[model samples]
Target: MSKRVNRVAEQMKKELGDIIFQKVKDPRIGFVTVTDVEVTGDLQNATIFISVLGDDSDKEASLKGLNTAKGFIRAEIGKRIRLRVTPEIEFAFDESIAYGSRIESLLTQVNNESKE
Candidate 1:
């Protein structure tokens, strides 16, 4: 990605996080965090990665809520940022946090076993 695209993705990540928290009032979107954003080379589309702090059902609910509100979020982005055409946004669940937690737990278990 070019410097410009990278900047846009970062900016989108920040703004989307704020927008989801401050602007979006859906209860389904609880404890959501914007983990990362990936933009296409042409800036025609963006994939927003998110982590939801809850169980499987909560994560799915948040994803569904974000998808349902995609158009509104895109319009908000268009208003906040100057772009010829706002990149189409899609919300996706980011599993990195969960994976990291699992790794940490496994390491702790191994350490405990070694001590025993």
Candidate 2:
């Protein structure tokens, strides 16, 4: 990604997080943190990675709420940022945190076994 694309993604990440937390009033979207945003080179599309503090059902519900509120979020983004064409956005669950936690636990287990 070029500097322009990177900047846009970062701005989107900030704006989206604010919009979700402040503007969107969805009950299912509780405890959602926008982890990252990935934008295409052309800036026509964006994938928003999010982390929800709950089980699979909560995550899925949060995604559904985001999808349902996509129009409002995009409109908010357009108003917040000056873009020729607002990139269409999609929500995705960020698994890196969970993956890292799993890896850390496994390492700790191995370390304990080795110590014994």
Candidate 2: lDDT of 90?
87
Residue pairs with clashing backbones, model 2: none
- For model 2, residues 1-116, the per-residue Cα lDDT tens digits are 89999999999999988999999998988799999999999999999999999999999999999999999999999999999999999888899999999999999999999999
Model 2 spans with C-alpha error above 4 angstroms: none
TM-score of 2: 0.97
Q: Candidate 1 has which clashing residue pairs, if any?
A: none
Q: TM-score per candidate, in order? A: 0.98, 0.97
Candidate number of the best TM-score: 1
| Tens-digit lDDT track of model 1 for 1-116 | 99999999999998998899999988888899999999999999999999999999999998888888898999999998898989999888889999999999999999999999
